[model samples]
Target: MSESLLRVVPTVPDWVPAQDAADAAALVVSAMCPGAGELVACRYAEVTFIDQGANFEAVGCPVCTAPLDGDWWQERMDDAYATRFATLDTVTPCCSATVSLNDLEYHWPAAFARFELQVRNPGRGWLSPDEAAQVSTVLGSTVRQVFSHY
Candidate 1:
């Protein structure tokens, strides 16, 4: 894991603007919790934008306990729509699940593209030895990924 460092603030850096970030944050908060009442109920009062380059991970909320992976797909879509980041080179079946209120469905196509996810840990989570192999394999892609962790 990489150690967190304290340093002087940067005058100029590669980043999106503060206003844009607030707008983006608003969009995210709204989507996650729709309706004005919910908006008022939920706390999105302060949105902090810390520059954690390359390695970034989302911590799940306590109530819904939704995994950050839930947002990962939409984030990719946003990248395609907003930033036009490229997709993985290969899409392989990683996991499967069924979602239903009344009827049960089987055999859902829940796959993970083993493309350059960059796999930067950012020192937040520890990477197991086995996980490191998978990360290495991702780094071995022949084609260049649009969003590079480097």
Candidate 2:
């Protein structure tokens, strides 16, 4: 059976909050998603990719707004992976503009983060902007949510 995930990540890829902040944020998430089956707060030693899983649609150049080639994106991802995602900088295949992979416009809003808060099977849909802002305020960082089904 498919599982739905509500994944939240900080806007800054390398940012990880204090343990107390993470704990508080987890509690707030639990209260916000009361119907969720499981909630996990993860801290990574290095930045990690957070994808939208089966919800992925397409990626576009942030500069030109042209659709980026999947193969080309894969190559860049591979290169970034070589450094364990420490460097996301690349020249856009569409516009030749230097940009960070983190800046790419992912349709499903994938991201890189050293910290993640995940709610599995949240009975409700996406979080509203105000809810996100609340979480962000508690965590002391701007955050983005990614909805995933897999």
Candidate 3:
């Protein structure tokens, strides 16, 4: 059976205190996915890609909204991974606009982050903007949610 995950990550790929992460996770569970178990907070040594698993559809340039070539995106991802994601800067092939890979328009809202709060089988829809803002307040940073199915 497939399970859904709701991953909350900071808007910027920066670190936050473990307590802050735990508080954010607790907030999401209590206010939204009360039945959700396996809540976890993670902090990576470096920025890492947090994808939406099989939910991913397409990615596009944030500037021109042109559909990005998969091969080109992969190449850029590889280059960034080589540096442990220290940099996500790239030039969009469509408009030659310089932007961060993290800023791309992803269909399922993927992101790069050093910290994440994940709830497995959340049993609820996406968080409301108000709820997300509450989580953001708890974490002291703006947050984005990534829904993943696997």
Candidate 4:
């Protein structure tokens, strides 16, 4: 079976409470986008690496936009799985510039430990900036949105 999720996670990942996440998620449903009513059925959850699946692939360098090699991608996935803080420094093959792995984008929704608010089957769209900002405000920390499938 395939499922789609709209996840709101605190950027710090360590300071969010499940109750706050739940409340923020409810606010997202009421104040966000058009299809956000779908979020009403969702709940709060803790995020983990296992949520990544084999879809855990890294993208290009955030600076030069050079695609990562297979070995580099594997190394990134390994680090993500093994470390609590998944940031890493690697040289880009194209520009030879050093970049933080956190700076690079990902092909899939990477897991964030601590807390996340998950909206299952949130119809067919993403959250607006205002909605995200509201969640961030409620959580008392910066937050990010992640879309995932399983």
**Which candidate wins on TM-score?**
2
Please report, in order, the local distance difference test score of every candidate based on alpha carbons.
0.26, 0.93, 0.86, 0.61
* Candidate 2 C-alpha lDDT tens digits along 29-95: 8899998999999888899989999999999999999999999999999999999999999999777
On TM-score, who's better, 1 or 2? 2
Kindly give the stretch of ten consecutive residues in candidate 1 with the minimal lDDT sum.
100-109
Model 4 spans > 4 angstroms off: 13-58, 86-91, 96-98, 108-111
Instruction: List ranges where model 2 is wrong by over 4 Å.
Output: none
**Which 10 successive residues of model 2 have the least lDDT summed?**
21-30
Better of 1 and 3 by lDDT: 3
Instruction: Give the CA lDDT, 0 to 100, for residue 2 in model 4.
Output: 74
After superposition, candidate 1 runs with Cα above 4 Å error: 1-4, 7-49, 53-57, 70-150
Candidate 3: give its CA RMSD in angstroms: 1.5
* Model 3: how far residue 44 lies from native, Å: 1.0
Tens-place lDDT digits, model 1, residues 3-103: 33111111111222244433443343334323222221111222212223343343332234344343554453354334322322211122332221101
**lDDT string, candidate 4, 1-150, tens digits:** 777777766665444556755676567554554554355423224324324444556677667777778687667657755664444456777788876554566676553546666667677666778867777766676776677767
Clashes of each: 0, 0, 0, 0
> How far off is residue 50 in model 3, in Å?
0.3
Q: lDDT per residue, candidate 3, 9-111, as tens digits?
A: 8899865556755675566556677878678887888898999999989999999899999899999999999999998999999999999999999998999
TM-score-sorted candidate list, best first: 2, 3, 4, 1
How many backbone collisions does model 2 have?
A: 0
Worst 10 residues of 3 by lDDT: 20-29
